[model samples]
Target chain A: MKEKIHIIKIGGSLIDDTELLDQFLDQFSGIKGKKILVHGGGKLATTLADKLGIEQKMVNGRRITDKDTLDIVSMVYAGSINKNIVAKLQQKKCKAIGFSGADANLIKAKKREHAEIDFGFVGDIEKKSINKKLISKLMKLELVPVFSAITHDKKGNLFNTNADTIASVIAQALSAKYDVELLYCFDKEGVLEDVDNPQSLIKTISEEEFSNLKNEGKLHKGILPKLENALSAVKNNVNKVFLIKETQLKNHIENHHEGTEIC
Target chain B: MKEKIHIIKIGGSLIDDTELLDQFLDQFSGIKGKKILVHGGGKLATTLADKLGIEQKMVNGRRITDKDTLDIVSMVYAGSINKNIVAKLQQKKCKAIGFSGADANLIKAKKREHAEIDFGFVGDIEKKSINKKLISKLMKLELVPVFSAITHDKKGNLFNTNADTIASVIAQALSAKYDVELLYCFDKEGVLEDVDNPQSLIKTISEEEFSNLKNEGKLHKGILPKLENALSAVKNNVNKVFLIKETQLKNHIENHHEGTEIC
Candidate 1:
């Protein structure tokens, strides 16, 4: 039997539309073998952070997660966002368990302290500590593992990791033979060649082409990270990545259309 | 002037009621000096676990936290519950930061694996590693620290710690002059001498009297650990403990009346 694994990256924007998320889960439920969900809670994290009076700072579209910001992000991503999705899935009759990087040392990370810039609580994964046995046990029970983009160091310090990167890492680690399809669901249809025009959605793009678009300022700041993440996933053995609109989730899954595919 | 600190335990039941939680926050805005919030999310955690098809178990009222359960609990406690409180506080114009034991190695712990029964992913606090510096830094910035009762082993593995115990530990470590109060707020009005009668609310009880009631089987299973925690806190320099209804929070803080005071 050819093992099938689908790694889906659900963006923070899609979380609000419960209907869309439900449709995505329903589609996921039909698929056989393992399915991993890597979710982004950037907008939700920021909303909660602002409500907590925690000042949020960003550099080049990435949140400069200080100690305070990291705390809020960890809580929103690993806590509320993870459980809410699990709850919704369970409501839809799908078994789903939420996890953070700290659980079973599933995602061990090393501190990435950039010398020139202070990236207070950022981490890079330590591959050896990734526990496949634990994941396999959960899969045998037919439970979907929902992950938050947070990792911990060997000394027990928690760090804020990029959701896209975390999803890519998990997909590669599982290595279930099927293409890891990362869905960076956003408000728009897909990556646009011209920001002002809706019809200019780039259906396909190579790494160089994406980089050129980035250099030309045609790609929006928010979409740049998603594109970078998509390319990284492909480079790291994830078969394909999709940048699609949230509303087009069902169509994208069923027909593999309505999004720009990066392979 | 003597340094003052307030240690408040916001019950899980209160958190479940969004309107009531907001009212509590409105009252909390009037509180002065440094404040620390220790929270519980057993109900939410169990709900998520059941939704995920994970069986929930308890031994002596403490959740039997296995690796998988620990993951879910961490998400609910440190992530969801902690962030919600912080966000609410922020909305009320208060500076709040959410934290677990993992960040800054705030609370160091050793695994408590006993001979008869193993408490998987459970830890006993190791005092030396408690990061008072982080708390002080936050305090200087006038940020309220919202804590989730999750600890980390020396090797960085996340463990489930009791919120009451964590509150007691922090209170003792800080050595603040203000009375440390553990408000074990629940659905009930207060701890009762007679379980059946609503009017049997025990107005006051010494440690010995509370133990006698327990021996007679009047003090029931649910309140045993709470009493143990309250007594432990009092013994460890926390000036006082209170078991109260969530509705009487403002009155309890202001007048120190309307609850069962344990000493």
Candidate 2:
């Protein structure tokens, strides 16, 4: 029997809020068994970018990362924010070791090659890129690995990557060794029938319903990628995937019944 | 017989230069057995601080780390510079993990309280604070641990620390399990007698000679702490300690005959 590993990913908004981050940390530290936490760059990165006077490269509402933006993200995401989380977790008595892709080549990525978009430093985490043995060793020592969404090419160029994609890929990679569950925690209760209503939580999202929602164009652009990532993880043998509200985190972890389950 | 661990400490000047850093990395990677690299922040931190208009707190010719200065140093030293070095080491096939003191509570520190000068966020690392087992586990996996001079108070405040002290403490802590040698790599070949002539390298310095140099005021302000750190490490049973030039790194590592040996 494979030991279970919980791979939880927290977005920027939750991390950026002090009270909520403390709540999340308390709840996360309570999780039993081997686990890993992946974190996104919060609004702090954008604020730093603004402070640095580095303009974003936008074409058709899509932001392309240039060298300057990459540096700012590296400093904010990999530096202060990441350290902040690690320190807080230590206070919570969780043995947490923070990581960037550049730190031990845990994840190596090549820059995205789309002729249409010059996303200078954005990298997609490659398949087989997760160093499973290193992670497993850390886990064996009862250490929880905390990761920032900053990866690098083996050639030493750091790249910004989507936190959700990083979570999904890591789930798929670790599924071979551990029974993995990937959780996407956010503000909404779950997949909502009425996007604006907090009470309209969809308990479970099936593949057919996901297809119908895609065809109906009811899924917002923001949720589309997350759903896609969740679906892909399920198909790739992840034991479970959950989209839950940040407030419902404790209940979901304790009850194991709330949140939208994707199958 | 105890296994050997090389704890090499590199100063700011060598890390600031691309060519010198590459040279150092190449030589350091060639070193066999369990090893760790402790690096100081280069000119980049000071440059970024100047650009952000964060003034240095200098009192009576002594630099104090105010809160703002601590944040900048943490960002530059632990974030970008540390990650950059880890990435390059990965390219060299050295599995390198970058760290700040907060990670895994590896080094717990107390804020410095001096009556004369208020060093705002400066921390003195506590005794027995080094997590030797965590480090030994990493070395057991053939991973090189690279550290920046940032430690936290466990209450979530990150403080600026000296890399030399970090190296000395880590070496002393690991000496029980491994024969440790602490190397302080900087600009000069060694401690120079003339201070102006590079060829006047003091190949070795004893406890008596060190006291003489100190009383004569021949020791510069910067090198004092490093030499003090080295002497303390020697007293604590570290097998060897050296102050060597960055350029002579390869020769020192391979031949084991260069650098200023302190006894």
Number of the predicted model whose DockQ against the real structure is largest: 2
Cα lDDT tens digits, model 1, A1-263, are 44666777777667767677777767665656677888887576676556556787877655577987876677668775665566555545555656666653567677786756667788876335456666666566566778878776545467788787787677666655444566676778788887777799999988889878878888887787778777876777766678887667667777867778886
The DockQ score of candidate 1 comes to 0.08
The best candidate by lDDT is 2
What does candidate 1 score on TM? Answer: 0.55
Clash number for each model: 3, 0
lDDT, candidate 2, B29-121, per-residue tens: 888888999999989889888877889989877789987888788888889889889988888888889999998888888888888888888
lDDT of each: 0.71, 0.88
Error of 1 at A132 (Å): 39
